[model samples]
Target: MGVVKDWRDKELSISEVIRKYPHISPFVIIKTDVQRRGVNYTEKALAKVDPDIHQVEYRGMFREKGDATPVSLILRDGTSILTAFSVEEGKREPILVDVIDDRIVLVDQGEILEEVEYWEKPDYYDKFTSSGKPMWQIAAARPQRIDINPNQYCQFWETPGHGCKYCSIAATYNSSKENKPKILNVDDIAETVEEALKEPGRYESIFLTGGSILNGKELLDEEVDLYIEILKRIGKNFGGKRFPSQLIGTAFNEEQLRRIYDTTGLTSYTADIEVLDKDLFEWVCPGKSARIGYDEWKRRLYKAVEIFGVGNVTTGLVVGVEMATPKGFQSEDESLEKCLAEAEELAKHGVSTVGCVWNVAPGSVFFNQMSPSLEYYIRFADGLDQIRRKYNLNVDMDNYRRCGNHPDTDLSRI
Candidate 1:
């Protein structure tokens, strides 16, 4: 949720915000807005989804059970907009994914904002693992990456007031009618990635992220051990000692972090510090705070930088989440100021910050909240980009070609 409003309860329209920030790419702005205020598919738009051609069904992270709805949208310039439709009610007028002149486009109130296309399905999507598990369920494909979620269920949700307020992983898992594995089998993953790599030039990196496994030998040792095992199996595909891979898991201490870096071919690491500020982090991500305090979390990120090296170690921010009600900052101005300052501090230590647009997930505590204005998001994006420039840190691991969910990282293409 990010935008600077010209008046109370009213923010500048996406077009108005674009005109205001002439330097920022309109496609990124549209993607950011679509992320904040979700998207609704027109019948004509949904008709374009061919199960055999386009990537349609997905393993949803939010509250909607996945089916064919064009998993997400992609702009003509290769920017991926990872938006989703929610089953539960939330407040916001989602833009329309409609067909215009026989082409897929994003429309707002009868006006075409930008032409888009559905993500193409990887060849391995329809295939099956050696164990007879669907390959799609083992490794989900992004436009330029293969994602493997080892653990479907997070331990953080077991205790009340310990879960992240903005996350819907628990709600999504508990509400689903289908019987699924809590932790995916290693053989299924290795076989899935093995088949997926056969698709030439389709993937640039392999990403692994899952719910925080708090019960380990030490804090997050179980989570770290799981990634190393899956990675070593995936490493058999390549000859090099280091592969183009990233693991976004719990913030492991130096010892656990070393086990992953020294044992696997993974070249990059990310432990998402969801919110920027320590106080906001505690309120929004109580579980993380309980497991690894905010100060210690930052220290662990600095430790990751030491292990993974610069440009390879990064942290993720759920941008605009600092404005949550009751405990969050009240003004967009204050939230932006607070987040960018913290991001800059991390950058000084050679840690690059990548942000994802924060939308009110259906099952989240903030389901009824409204996001910040579009202007606020654009400004915040530009600020993040500028901070990287100032620190001379690069976001190569999470850029447009690797992970395009962050609107700020998409600007790096320019």
Candidate 2:
């Protein structure tokens, strides 16, 4: 594949990307592009959204508003395209979601790409806990998983310039005044999970992830303790010692890893490396690099495999950040080569790599930076997917059903 000189001037469309990568799902390609360029609803499309039936309010830590806009869209094959439209200075124009022929469709450059449906609201979204806090505010839901953010604030931003360049956690946390609590009550979380489980066949797994918690007796010990407490509380709902759960927390040492693995019903573990290259890792995520060097982070992931077992432990990369200007690799080919090489090394140690298309979110340091082209993401997702297959790895915990964010993991469904 030839690299385009200017990403904006490149004429290669989603249809072309699908034709080039025939084996990769077209739905997956569409999901990647929609995520890369966020979506905005047309007046007609917005008219189609019913808050009673469709999920509208923003429920996660990322977005502050609980506005009645469509939360996200779902493709025909159950693949999710997660997007948020926040009006901010220097943000890219979103793709249009308009009504075509009496059906909702995605329009890009005056082309009707595909039909899409709004994500249905989960049953428990409307219910409130005994403490009068709305259950939906405590835990958000995807099509097949429950997302809980136990800690909403990340300590990395407390430092002058330590937070990840491609993250908007602190900005989003500070902007909104939603009634949701900063630190979720354990009982509230447990109660919400118990209520969510009542909807039979609705949820396949439970996912827990949040901003980095740097304060601890040892590094990330406080973060580990928080997860252990929440996991134990949620464990009460299950009959066995373990349940279908995944925790994407900070990279912890062996002792902290063992504490969660041994005590709770958590099944899988993940620590997002963000960017694969060592120098880029330090530049993109200075907080993580300063606290836990890139090499040590990889070491912790390997140790997690020993504790969580092969196919149960994984690391995530924000796929396109390696191409950010000034410090990132100049060429897409060089970036992909170095990234896959590092990912392959991790795969050898029983750690699988998943890709989340980097959205240059507003308020992030990289807010004005451009993400790589669509072809780059398709190739990146395919490369990571192929690596897992060669190693005979399974991404069930983060696959399409459990967590639909990763295009590489969505390929595992096939």
In order, what lDDT does every prediction score? 0.84, 0.87
Residue 237, model 2: lDDT of 82
Expressed as tens digits, the lDDT of each residue in 1-414 for candidate 2 is: 121245556546788998988999999999988888778778788778787888886445554333467877899999988775333332345578999999999898899989999999999998999999889889999879999998898999999899999999899888867754557899999999999999989998999999888888898888999999999988888874799999999999999999999999999999999999899999999999999989999999999999999999999998889999899999989988999999999999999999998877778898878778889998899999999999999999988877888899988788
Q: Give the TM-score of candidate 2.
A: 0.94
The all-Cα superposition gives candidate 2 an RMSD in Å to the true structure of: 3.5
**Full-model lDDT, candidate 1:** 0.84
Residues 228-342 of candidate 1: C-alpha lDDT, one tens digit per residue: 8899999999964788888898889999999888989999999899899999889999999987999999999999999999888889988878887888888888888888999
Looking at model 2, the pairs that clash are none
User: Which 10 residues in a row give candidate 1 its minimum summed lDDT?
Assistant: 58-67
Model 2, position 310, has a per-residue lDDT of 99
